[model samples]
Target chain A: MTRVHDMGGRFGDGPVDPSPEPVFKEDWHARALAVTLAAGALGQWNLDTSRHARERLSPKDYARFSYYEKWISALADLLEENGVVTRDELMAGQGAGPSPLSGRKLRADAVAGALARGGPADRPVDSAPKFAPGDVVRTRRPARNAFVAGGHTRLPSYAAGAVGRILHHHGAHVLPDANAHGRGESPEHLYTVVFDAAELWGAPERAGDEVTCDLWQSYLEPA
Target chain B: MPHDHHDHDHAHAVLPPDPALRVKAIETILTQKGLIDPAALDEIIDTYENRIGPKNGALVVARAWTDPAFRAALLEDATAVVAELGFYGRQGEHIVAVENTPEQHNMVVCTLCSCYPWPLLGIPPGWYKSDAYRARAVREPRKVLAEFGVTLPGDTRVRVWDSTAELRYLVIPMRPEGTDGLNEDDLIPWVTRDSMIGTGLPGRPE
Candidate 1:
């Protein structure tokens, strides 16, 4: 539940390195991204599943993996899980026999159009939003069992259980928690919750500093 | 080529990192399986590597600096306004442009993941994805901004936006003083990727 990937508010990691570099440094990084995007376009697994696959890796390995390495590993895991390819096939870099295609290949010519027309997750719901701007709310501190079973959540560990004010109601959107696990869309009211630094961390930090996060309604309750 | 056991060490030394090799291996296998098209892969890479980048976002920022109407439209509906300028896509689908005033400053981070507006900012920088930045940005934002050589006045209110949903954020950094005469084209260079991300301020004219 409290995985190594969820590194928020913890200390002693060291200073942030502010260096500039190209998006993809090595040739493999670009290839990894390309392969991941291609496989993802197949509609076999959702983004959440891919993310969970990476999180499921051993903490040691997860820590060791670069950004694209994580993506490739997850892609490999998903391919094996979906029976698209075998572990041996992945290892050998060649299939033993002909495999069925996904039939949903993103052609090169359509790349620009596809990117410009991005997927909008907002969905209409039957009910009115529970919270509104200026409403006081407390983030639900997820139970240990729930956290373990939920797979992934949009609620970060640092924001959980903290009290904050709703700065704005962002309308209903697909809940990532359910969408990640192939449960359902389960759209909910999203809010911009603003937490004072003193409220999240402690006093004596900066009095005027605040952290604002877009939190789904399910993750909050009236304070 | 014949398999040679004695050259394994030399082969390993010559090969790239294990991750890179593994990715190449997977790509090869997927291509053989006909699940992935190499041309499509190149197309996707080229789009992000060339077609999309901070320059697109810089144009948006520069317009906001020179034109009050465009700035108002951007702050009100960033998605449509940015799309009007041809910067809308995957992560940039839903954007909320927060303006940095003299009294208040804005910063952005994704504690859960590196969720950035790719169409606006291109691929996120390395530090933005680092554990240190993710963990400390919200806790010690002043310190974090200071490390980036951005020293805000202690009296200014620092607002850190943690992107937890599909709505991506972009900081409409305050227009630097003494730039009233500059046109939108001239102001583009002053706007940096870090400024839009709120890690650093826009470059000042020397």
Candidate 2:
């Protein structure tokens, strides 16, 4: 489905104001980010799961909230949905008892270590890549509201059905569509496909410009 | 239509709903549940705020400019090469370093979400994560570049990399001219945050 979160190339976004700004415009933004990260370190869900949770909001809420605000709200829902915390306790602003998952909590000294040794998504796969660097490919075009189980998809809406050439193979990685759901880590050969900007936007004047996207094998078909 | 006048769905919405207060409440609840460590949150915030940032990326660019072998290593295997310099972490896994040339200029964006090399360039800028950038960078990069005051030559091919998967992209912007006499350390100041992101070029040597 072309969810609100996937709004690439949907016009009327207006000119980008690339003004210089601080990392966190407000103090709460930092707290919100750190809290979300710390809670995520509890081993309750994976990165893809967190991303899906953020995308689960209603169309109205998703459009209204700020970046970190969405993070904070999604985290609250995940904490309850994953059974890490109870809704009643969250409403009461007090724990019913002692913290259950003490062993999994990230401590202060270990924060840097955890951030350094990131959760690597690359896994061993028994299959070889089907396409090479020079092969031409076309992205899978799903009908609007018809996608892979209606879960998280890395293929932006704009690239659907667009033709491009494989620039390089990025090795087999976890397929987010399956991983975001409860399905297993279905690995797929990922490749960088380069598309001419003119072809992407149907503009003849922009012939020299190009755009490259990192796509999984399933999202492409030989052209 | 007016049955639910108030936001009864999110109980907190009934409150003032101030972002700061809302975050404080969530942190308090998670702390009470023992799911989050307050100290860890502080550490994560402090580390990103002060310790890690664009300086690390600038240093990497400087080393690449001074050492051809290092630049080759970077383009070949950025994850391993950057790790050798003690720069490796979350949101930066499986990096691909694309160099910018006069013939083709490279820029990076995440149309799906905000996926940046945090260990190197730190948190993404506000504009980088905006809806406008995510929507337009992949579609009309030349126009986007012009808005950033980056007026490229008419012939230079603009290559926009829309980061969609686990692999993060880092643009090796072309080194500024007239800085041939500078050392690696001296070259560090020439690199800026936007330069690495492919939005703005590095400043001239002072």
Q: What is the TM-score of chain B alone in each candidate?
A: 0.90, 0.91
lDDT of each: 0.81, 0.83
lDDT of 1 by residue, A96-176 (tens): 665666467666776678778878878999989999899999997851214236367778888789999999887899887
Please provide, for model 2 over A14-129, each residue's C-alpha lDDT reduced to its tens digit, 9 standing for 90 to 100.
88898888888899999999998898888887888788766666667778888888888778777776778776876776667667686788999999999998878888888999
**Per-prediction TM-score:** 0.93, 0.95
- Model 1 steric clash pairs: none
lDDT value for candidate 2? 0.83
Top candidate (TM-score) = 2
Interface RMSD of 2: 3.7
Among these predictions, the greatest DockQ belongs to 2
- Residue A7 displacement in candidate 1 (angstroms): 1.0
What is the Cα-based lDDT of residue B29 in candidate 2? 76
Which digits, one per residue and each the tens of the lDDT, describe model 1 over residues B9-117? Answer: 2222222348877788777877776777899889888988888888988899999999999999988899999887888888888899999998999999988778899
- Which residue ranges in model 2 land beyond 4 Å of their true spot? A143-148, B1-16
- Residue A207, candidate 2: alpha-carbon lDDT: 76
